[model samples]
Target: MRNDVRALRLSGGLSQAELAGAMGVSRQTVNAIETGRYSPSLTLAVRLARYFERTVEEVFHVDCD
Candidate 1:
């Protein structure tokens, strides 16, 4: 999976920690997601999309093999 999280966060003037705080997750978790080291759960993905005023499809893209 790939996401525009870093770009969105930067455009929104939010640090990883700030984004994490808004999503109620650890900064490390946010970092992991942004870096593609981890994939967020369905619930977290929805929360993230809602926070950015976007749909999940706008925030995340699944790369097909």
Candidate 2:
């Protein structure tokens, strides 16, 4: 999966640690997600989308690989 997490977080002026804290996850988790090393679960995805005031499709995109 590819996501706009990094861009969004940066645009929102949030650090990975801050985002992780807000998301109730570890900084590593946020790093992994931003780097496409890990994909968030559906529930977590929804939470993230909601937190950013974006739809899941807007936040995350299928890589089409």
Candidate 3:
């Protein structure tokens, strides 16, 4: 999966730690997500998209390989 998390965070004037605080996760977790090393759960994904005022599909992209 690929996501716009980093761009969104930056455009929203948020640091990884700040985004994590809002998302109720750790900065490391936010880093993991941004780096594509980890994928968030559906619930968390929804929350993230909602926080950014975006749809899940807008924030997350399912890569076909």
Give the per-residue lDDT digits (tens) of candidate 2, residues 4-27.
Answer: 999999999999999999999999
Instruction: Please write out the lDDT profile of model 3 over residues 1-65, one tens digit for every residue.
Output: 89999999999899999999999999999999999999999999999999999999999999886
In model 2, the Cα lDDT at residue 6 comes to: 96
Each model's lDDT: 0.95, 0.97, 0.97
Worst 10 residues of 2 by lDDT: 56-65
lDDT of candidate 1 vs native?
Answer: 0.95
How far off is model 3, as Cα RMSD? Answer: 0.8
Clashing pairs in 3: none
Per-residue lDDT of 1-65 in model 1, one digit per residue for the tens?
89999999999999999999999999999999999999999999999999999999999999887
TM-scores across all candidates?
Answer: 0.95, 0.94, 0.96
Each model's Cα RMSD: 0.8, 1.1, 0.8
